[model samples]
Target: MWVQLRRSARTHVASVKGVAWTLFLFTYTDYKTIFFPVTAFACVAAPVQSYTRLLHGVIWIWLNLLQCNSSNQYKSAEEDALNRPWRPLPSGRISRSQASKLRWSLVPICIGFSACYGWDVVLANAFLTLTTIMYDELGFAGHWLGKNFCNIFGYVTFEIGATKIIGTSTALDYTAMISILYSALVIFTTIQTQDFPDVIGDSALGRVTIPIKYPEASRKFTFVAMIAWSVFFSSTWALGTLSSLIFCVLGAYVGSRIYLLRTVQDDKRSYVIYNVWLLIAHLLPAQTRWNVLPF
Candidate 1:
């Protein structure tokens, strides 16, 4: 019964639903659920419940993104305003009050969901809440050292959280170790690559991001290094684990990098497309099992 109206009037209702469902799919493709399939069962009862879980994931991801965005340094109160005028918050599509209210609302919902899983999940969610507060409210992420700590702790909490929810030690298994390493590499690469789009905005605001500190060419090189390392890691996994799923996942990453590399000269569409491809690669493993091919 979750109806979503489109920006157009004549669009069929199902079309609107399709777009809404797509958003939900991408939103649920987060670190916690990507490997583990926490929200998978919600689809069995009513397709609408899957949509709700997707909405929850999208809201959670956006809020977290906003929280991270606040970590950038700004010169004065005028420039330091967290929400830029073009953003959804400042644009009045959604009010600042609404965002704040929604953030608090989502926290409890996340906690409740985790509690349904187990106490360990609840504890992990508690830690995540604290970390979110520290980054958003306390301005800890602006500090260089604190930024690194946030990166490391964020994944740790994600692993712990999913482990508790799945009710298994899969998080600590060899597969989990590979996943953690893979995730960390992709995250760092993503952070670095994203700097290209925000370089002007961040530099104007006097932020001390890695890309702002280094040359522009270095940013491109960093991406290349990430691609190389990703290939190496995936090949290693295929060799040792011999999982066809590993190769499928690897194909996505390599294909994305190839696309990025070819279109690096065209920054506008290429950057966005590159990110879409990366997301596909990141989430592909979640839905399929890695089967080893018999030679």
Candidate 2:
């Protein structure tokens, strides 16, 4: 009986680990794009929340991410196969039909998760769901302008919902709203930086991304935005001279790479650096909340 019990425990442990590994593989790529940013904004905006509340917020974001990624990956399997072959559907971790089922099933799960927070979060999730539909099904992602519009609003919902969860309030205060809008504006301008590295795959598919639409202009504009936004955010956030200098340096590094390198691999590296800057930008709100740094 003792041996049987130990064997059962080991089997259960192995099963748990298997599940965890599967989830990790499905969602790891989005850690930079979604999970980390949402968590950062939440923690920065509401630093005093309980661990349990934060964990619940994490679960909420995870549910929405599962829905978002599964849906987008289901539809973009061909693109992923070309540009990001290791993704679940492209790599055969799941079939297209299976992914479709998982995608649709997550919708209600996300809604239920949001209901715990209130109708406010539910509305936020609903807007994101609508944005996903527009981007994935309505052909919004096929055009550069439509893509940015969807992305701007989609990420804004994420910021708002996450802030509400960790802040333990259905209604965001005025400052939180302003900060989230600032983040949204940041995303609207630079989110297309993600498209630069996908030029080849996008070209193969005849997709029109900002990078593909105006190759020369896109890189130059990104360079300008990086420098301009860095100065704007640092000044508006009232970051100290040293802190602002560090922010500008990161911006300069990313901007220069995007403008100068003009290669797939270089753009990939620059995109990662851009996400780092964006993540730090998300934390700037904490400077408003608490004296995170001194001049």
Q: List RMSD in Å for every model shown.
A: 8.5, 2.0
lDDT of each: 0.46, 0.86
lDDT for each residue of candidate 1 in 48-113, tens digit (9 for 90 to 100): 224444554434334433333322211122332342344333334444555465556767677776
Which digits, one per residue and each the tens of the lDDT, describe model 2 over residues 56-90?
88988888888888888888888998988887778
Distance (Å) between predicted and true CA of 48, model 2? 3.9
lDDT of 1 at 99: 48
What candidate 2 gets wrong by more than 4 Å, as runs, is: 1-19
Q: Which stretches of candidate 1 lie over 4 Å from their true place?
A: 1-86, 141-149, 163-171, 239-289, 292-295
lDDT of the structure predicted as candidate 2: 0.86
lDDT of 2 at 188: 91
